[model samples]
Target: MNKFGVSAQTLIAAAFGAAIMGSAFAVPKLLAPEAGAQPIAIQAPPGAPLSFADLIEKVEPAVVSVNVVSTQDLSELGDMDQFFEQFRGMPGLEDFFEQRREQQEQETPRTREARSLGSGFFISQDGLVVTNNHVVERATQIQIVMSDGREIDAELVGADPLTDLAVVRVKEPGPYPYVKFGSSKDIRKGDWVVALGNPFGLGGSASAGILSADGRELGAGSPYTDFLQIDAPINRGNSGGPTFDLKGNVIGVNSQILSPTGGSVGIGFAIPAELAKEVTDTLIQNGRVSRGWLGVQIGDLTPEFAEALGIEDVKGALIADVTTGSPAERAGLKRNDIILSVNGQKVTDSTSTTRLVAKLIANTKNKFDILRDGKPQSISVTVGERPADPNAISPVPGGANPAEPGAPSAVPGKMLPDFGVRLSPMDDATRIALGLRTGDTGLAITEVTKGGVFGEAGFEPGIIILDVNSRPVASVDAFERAIAEAKAANRSKVLLGLRVGQVTSYRTIDIPK
Candidate 1:
């Protein structure tokens, strides 16, 4: 087979727009199937047509192309030096810097209006619309262009960034045609699904493919993602659109695709209907979502871990720890207890458990089934409302130092290699450059072992270790003491507060073997 194709891997940006420029090549139309190649023939239970003409005709009316105009800084005269720094010894260094110097003659900050494209559909007869949060997030002005060429202004109902779901309302009062969600649980593997979206700003485009695997976790950016994998031809502008079942019910909302050349290679992902419905319903009601929290850290019960715990079957989520004063602690849920179900629903794994608990109302009592010491037990937990931003520390008026009352002592000058990380004391100049204020004492990561646990867990040089297990560690001795305590207690993971520049976050590292 003579194959000619480009490598494609593109994760759609959080904010999509036409301002992101690229060259487009017109694809040549094929006369027929080439040299022994055949067209794909698919059907629904052996009775549907190969083409989805009738289905598309019915659903296309509700589809729309969402355009958003936002104003932001495009470039700045001060950035010229940094931009030219990359081409330090390139062939056109002189020409590039000369042109940039000419442009710097004006010496002005560059700001411009940017346009982005994505697809969406009407979900209610009263003008309620559904789309991706990334599509309309931070949008200054939003315009919805219908399939029949009617442009309508829309207002943001609300958006949940954690779930990547959003809702908007149109100003024009009407009984607009909308799509309904079908049971995603009923959709099976290999079932025919249709995707409708404005791919690359082409309004009301549709592609068909079989359902791939479901319940995929994209890991970092999407910690709570349980995506429905599809083989549809979803592109950049397809975000916030709908994927439909044979009976014309929306099964999923297209959000991401797995590609290398910015084009679909038949591996696309969608937010499952159940999750989307849950998020949208909350957004419509409260104009916000409050996820229920149990305040317990958990991990999957793998077979090896289960056997180590002397359990017979590899099931349930292993409770790692319970937060103080949290709902889980108040409900008497102890560490090492395996959560088997939520409200009688089976907890397949830790991720599903998190998703299930998030759907429950705050301050509501939910039944949790657990395994404790080889016996099954049930407990009723009154879940608490999860905080909107966990990383956000409420600022005190006239910034008070939360550090200890005593004047800071000098830091030790020794380095460590026990945790696969070498620490160095941050000097006054380094501390000032890293944006650390008074009373801030963070140990700089002078070195990271690439093959060790620190690097494997994404730790790199230039990150400052601020604390260990919520204990502020200003010296190497403090850090070593924390690690020694955890190791003595036979703990596998030790949590650390890390400061990368001005932002601080938590990361867990596995104890080196």
Candidate 2:
């Protein structure tokens, strides 16, 4: 049973039945005025579209059907019911299914062929097409069917999985019909828009609806989300099809639909052309999209938190922690600093700040206005290239940690009863072997108790703790002092900067209750 108390199998059966018996679309007929002396034509509000035939005719030629053939391993397949779930044990089919299942079970490491259908559009005259990355991802063979009924083999030029956009090309000499991407900024809610795609394998289907909303994030992974929402009836086969404005310009790419019935429920999502253009342009030039990274952890400022920070307006991204040796730290950005603007544009939230920062070119200097200690401060920071995997932490090169200048006490190591770790001062010989500079301050973690918080937090031996809550700690006394200060200040967690071999990073740990 489905969550709505209907049989899930019943819905699937209904959909398959519709597919077999569905009829083609027909244009609506205009009703004649009933015996009136004066005749009036269809009227719409000013600047609204009353008709779509002209717009559809001008751009329909640019649309194409994307079909892919892929292979699936038999090991991935399960029992017989999986194959017959769609058939649902109908009359006179049980024995046939049983025989087929028995024959299939005799084979070892078998394979099967799968075919998928999707929609795409021509972005350039020389057979350059744009579609969703998922349509052609892992596809062994792809065929593009033009509106003229010509099927052409296409090659993948580039694909960006982060934005779900891809580019393909066919090396043909003749020019092809194409569509131009228009600015999504100009489109607004209640504006008339049209979606053209191969819905349900029906070629060149068109649906009309208004822009229901914009900047909708439907949790389609990746932080580059800024989906345009529309009431157009897009379906499974409509992925990567273009949604056009009244002037026949492509403003969005229909990507997803929100429906429990496996059909359009008047809620469909499209990748905004503005964001799509950026990703496709990068894919065209670099074959992949590269974004700038700030290496800072930021959070949205709640009203209560803002009031405590003495800010009248509860806006902007609050910096919770900055990575050690990162561009933000090198630029003097500190924890508790509020990011107000980037490149003179106001940042409404943490996500906006990330989007703005990512648009910046790596190694380019950008201006940022921040609120530090209740005062406005301006600073210039050079952006850095984002790592391939932002969540991974690499071990620092051995002997690269910096050591303190002072001499160690008689004993080098001491046990922390509360934190459940053995901390030790960095001796010169050990520091030299570890490649530490003379100015680095921190005690080395000799051991972390097996069941301790640090162990569960992924901390291992050989890493040096350089600072606690932004305060340098070269000895046990200093470490204890910093922890005391953090607790006294009523902070729930303390940020720690650690030197793992040559790499430097920051970690936040909760204060023990």
Candidate 3:
């Protein structure tokens, strides 16, 4: 078993399940259906619908198969001499290898048309369709196959890679059947959800399952979206299809699946309708989305951190570092401030805080409630437009060059036995190398004993200890004084503000009692 207590699996984008073509075979006469044969009937479980045929029929027409054809450059395929080398001495295989090489040499085409399949559904009568961005993002040509086998050429309208959603319009206009978005927030765990898609290129396939979970963050790839988890057996070629409630309203869009094999193992995720609808509308109106930027690196307030801060509840985001000249910096936001809320909405964690700030309109004043030095305060900041490249706003800090003439080198300092680390006073050279402000003061970690408390807690050499229990520590003496004060206060742990490389963060260390 893996760390998650389940078998290791891969998260696959459900977009391209290749359809296998097979030779036809004759059927036995004995296997043929008898005249006036009746369909098999199965007893329904309690509280279950007798059949989903009616619901499937109602929504099947709007669902479509997205066919994408893009050019693939094959010039990168290197020589095949090594591949043919293995068969040189094999019995009766020399001729086969030579023939293959000759055929490969004769083929001079450098590019080929690659076809991929996915699913989508019309969202308007004028042929506006919703699908995953990956489905048609690279398509040189797109075709939508309807339920009745009618093929209509389509063009990409707009796509949002952050949310993995896209809008496409059919070139041939018509009064098409479409589906409407429903409130995904109202859907509860265990509520029945029917997924309609073209799984494995099988057009108009439907699978029934419950909403396994909601508000799930897959990873860093989809920071803006909190995916709705389902067990609807959606598979490849199902990307961008709609998951419908019993009312035939689209509540989610099928996007990905977690499976040991490429096929679905029942764990699937979809984009919630609320976020999807919002992004779709914006894409339809604008070619791209522009999010608000707060310009602060934040971390979750853990229970240990709360104890250090003398707080009863650990329910806020800890501001680690504020960008220079950012909206946050201009609003007087500082390091170590705990964000309690944004615009009156209570901040739950770092992720929620990021999402909240991103939803704010650019150039608009927003209220932020924060806790500084155990006191509550509110500040108003005019949000700015997020940079096109997220990293452009907060690039990774460069490493220090101790070899430079004026760079500070590690010096022997007082050792904190309990923490198994030595501290040295920060100097002008160290501050400049760290790219810190002139007034910034801290005790740099000179050495960390392996397998000791500090090392186990992730403390390492070159890290600077900025504060102890919110008190600035400018030297080894100050760090010792703060530790003594914490011990005198009978605190079990003390929070330390640390500057690791260029990023600021907080870590709680146990106070030896």
Which candidate number has the best TM-score? 3
**How would you encode candidate 3's per-residue C-alpha lDDT over 1-513 as one tens digit per residue?**
433233333212111211222223322222334687754556765446767899999999999999999888775225577777878888779888788778877888688889999999999999999999999877899999999999999999999888899999999978999999998988889888999999989987999999999989988788888999999899999999999988899999999999989999999999999999999999999977889998888999988789887887659999888877788988999989999999999988898998999899999999999999889999999999887675455332343332232333466778888788888888877767665765888988888998677988887788888889888888888888998988887788899998766668888988765
Task: Give the residue spans of candidate 2 off by over 4 A.
Answer: 1-51, 70-114, 219-222, 323-325, 329-334, 394-513
- Candidate 2, which ten residues in sequence have the lowest lDDT sum? 393-402
Specify the highest-lDDT model's number: 3
Please provide, for model 2 over 1-513, each residue's C-alpha lDDT reduced to its tens digit, 9 standing for 90 to 100. 844444878777766666776645332333554664454455777787657898998999999999888787766337666876666667768778766777777778877888998999999888888999988887778888888888999888889787889988875654999999998889889989999998989978999999999988655275787889999889999999999999999999888889999999999999999888878888888888788888877877655455433357658887765665678878989766789999999998888888899889999999999987678989999989888765453212332444432333235588876777888877555545444444556788888897666776788777778777656788989988888877887766676767665445667666666
Task: Kindly report which residue stretches of model 1 are placed more than 4 angstroms away from their true locations once superposed.
Answer: 1-45, 71-112, 223-225, 323-325, 329-337, 366-380, 392-513
Tens digits of per-residue lDDT, candidate 1, 221-288, equal 67677889999789999999999998889999999989989999999999999888978998999999
lDDT of 3 at 82: 76
Query: lDDT per model, in order?
Result: 0.78, 0.79, 0.85
TM-score of 1: 0.63
TM-scores of the candidates in the order shown: 0.63, 0.62, 0.79
Residues forming the 10-long window of minimal summed lDDT in candidate 3 = 10-19
Better of 2 and 3 by lDDT: 3
Residue 424 lDDT (model 2): 87
| Collision pairs in model 1 | 8-259, 8-260, 8-261, 9-259, 9-260, 9-261, 17-116
Question: Rank by lDDT, descending?
Answer: 3, 2, 1
Candidate 1 — what's its lDDT? 0.78
